[model samples]
Each structure stands twice: as structure tokens, then as C-alpha cells.
Target: MENKDKTDWRFKVANREALIGCGLALLNFVWWFGFAYGMGSRPVEEYSYILGMPDWFFYSCVVGFLLITALVIFVVKVFFKEVPFEEEEELR
Candidate 1:
């Protein structure tokens, strides 16, 4: 009898895991890009500076990046499930 588990293509543990990983990664990328571009596009010298860095740089690029990084770390730790990888059969 054929192994239904091996032949089943409708759903896969690896595929689901990969999809979740890719979604999270894409979400992070979009968030960082939006932060960088949205803040970087504002008028120059509009706000007070921090440590000689522009407010946008200090807040958006530096602090914002840190915040987003932490958020991603938290989400991954809390939401991602650790799935075991399936072993492939060796060809005869």
C-alpha cells in the first residue's frame, strides 16, 4: 500500500511553516520600509534634533527600528510554533 502521508499534497507541515515565516518576514520588511520612507520624506529641520541627528533619523530610523525589531522578536517568540522537519526518503 502507498504511504498516504508521503503522497498527500493537499497540505504539508513544511509548506505551512514556510508560509507563516514568509508572511512574518514580509510584514517586517513593509513596516521598516514605511518607517524609513515616511519619516525620511518630511521637511528638514522641522523638529528638534537629538544628539546632533535629525529628529527623523533619531526617532524613525534609530528608535523606530529598535521598536520594530523588538516587536518582531516578540511576535515570533509568542506566535510561531516549532514544527519538526520531515525526513525525506533516500532514492534506491
Candidate 2:
């Protein structure tokens, strides 16, 4: 039996990816909240429309969703690393 080091590369990679995911989630929330509340706070009569949808809805829900989707894809493809799950056998 053997004990693995606490500072394994796999652990470091996992932690970094987790932090990046949390950051992206926070960014998404902030984007949604800002646009949804900032523009939506105005009176209905003064609201603007884009492609038949309210400006706030279009930007906050539609565009924000697309932007976040693209960002996540890019991050995963570029920054994330594939880690092996199998344990290594000790050399004799």
C-alpha cells in the first residue's frame, strides 16, 4: 500500500478548473442580473425592442446565453486538460 502526495498534479489541475468554472458562473450571473434589472427597471412605454423582443430580454437572456456558451466551449477546449483516472502501479 502507498500514500499519494497531497500536491499531485491531478489535484492542482482539478482545483484550477473548478475555480475557472466558478468564475464563469459568476460572470454569467452578473451579466444576466445587470441587463435584466438595469434596462428592465425603466417604464414599459420607454422600453426598446429588438427582433420583436424587449431589448433587455434579448441582451440579457439570448445574447448572454450565446456568449456564455461560446466562452465555456472555448475555455474547456483550450484551458482544460484530460487527466487519467487509473492508479499507477509501483515499480519493483
RMSD of each: 4.9, 2.1
Q: Write the per-residue lDDT of candidate 2 for residues 1-92, one digit (tens) a residue.
A: 54666356788899999999999999999999999999999999999999999999999999999999999999999999999998666567
Stretches > 4 Å off in candidate 1: 1-47, 88-92
How does each model score on TM-score? 0.53, 0.89
Which residue window of length 10 is worst by lDDT in model 2? 1-10
Q: Candidate 2 — what's its lDDT?
A: 0.94
**lDDT value, candidate 1, whole model:** 0.68
Best by lDDT: 2
C-alpha lDDT (0 to 100) for residue 24 of candidate 2:
100
Writing each residue's lDDT as its tens digit, candidate 1 over 36-77 gives 677767777565578998765676568867876786688678
